[model samples]
Target: HKGQELVMADIPGLIAGAAEGVGIGDRFLGHIERCRVLLHLVDASLPGPVEQWRVVREELAAYGGGLENKPEILALSKVDLVTPQALAAKKRALEKASGQHIYTVSAATKQGVEPVLDKLMEIAGRAQAMKVESDKSWSPI
Candidate 1:
């Protein structure tokens, strides 16, 4: 475990019309506005994992508020529930669609979680460094 501290919040699910007050609605979407990076956890055991990833992305983009532009990490969760072959296939598909690496993980079995956390820490550290540098550049007028 790294010494860096990271704060994370689990927002409600985003549906097709989340931006239009559908499902849990996008009221909480703004909570992520200040987040430097977003971790999108998609269920690998679900049918059409890629489609599910796209739906969430569309919701974020539609909601605007800079959420769409923030860096994102795609995590394929529930990997234990699916076969290795299936997991590999879905991970590849998601990576291709997202143009980023997909971290396969199983929360129940604690499988493949460390890599995801490690990556998150790395990204968060960089973001924090940038924020510090930006703050140092400001001065009272």
Candidate 2:
């Protein structure tokens, strides 16, 4: 077994019409509401990173029910396939696209994992800090 005590499921990739019971959409999206954060792993080498990003964004937004509000860290996976210069460029593009710090990682090579993990931990810390800062309802956004 993996060392982690908790399990996270990778649901079927959300498709168009998922919210309307098209192709296991409801069942797949049901779990997203419970998550505190979402690591949006996108393939950076795709033809149009921004366009692909919007497709996913549109799918989630159309899903409705506040799912769109979930805090997310945008990440581009499979960096090892590209040259270093290309990787940096892709990272910049994704960061600009998502309006968040973008991480380029290759899970296979273990490159860039630590920084990505650090960002996730940093976000968690900020969430805790927010709780301690004010009892009144204040959104992180």
Candidate 3:
């Protein structure tokens, strides 16, 4: 928003063996190294949603390169497909497992999207600022 631009790359869903060049994981994971932030969207309609989230995290940790340390905005996608009770349970499980606030969103209904984007913008802005500060610090004194 504003005069600045923030681009979000839609990377493929990472599988278990992604860190070892399984499927297209290694290639895409490499691209993630240069990213300022990671927006991890979990498909709430799927079975074992928390496991899905963990798998991606495991792959990123295995990939190394400080990928595990990157700032992650965890979101629950496809919320429109699940019932209110299921959604609430998923939220609790995901939040407890990931230890982060989970943003529930449905692109089809456009529900809970703006708040997520606003949070993303704030995080990205701070990340960009830190990078610029770090870049300026790399000087021989």
| Alpha carbon lDDT of each predicted model | 0.87, 0.72, 0.93
Show where candidate 1 strays beyond 4 Å.
none
Give a tens-digit lDDT track for model 1, residues 45-96. 8999989989989999999897888888889999999998988899888888
lDDT by residue for model 2 (23-135), tens: 88778788887665667778766656666667667777888867788777787888777777877777777778778777778888988787777666666567656767886
- The ten-residue window of minimal lDDT in model 1 covers 19-28
RMSD of 3: 1.3
Model 3 worst lDDT window (10 residues): 1-10
Instruction: Return the candidate ranking by lDDT, descending.
Output: 3, 1, 2
- Give per-residue CA lDDT, model 3, range 1-141, as digits (tens): 645678988889999999998999999999999888899999999978799999999999999999999999999999999999999999999999999999999999999998888888888999999999999989888
lDDT of 1 at 121: 87
Evaluation by lDDT, superior candidate among 1 and 3: 3
In model 1, residue pairs whose N, Cα or C atoms come closer than 3 Å (at least 3 residues apart or on different chains), thus clashing, are none
| Residue 84, candidate 2: C-alpha displacement in angstroms | 2.6
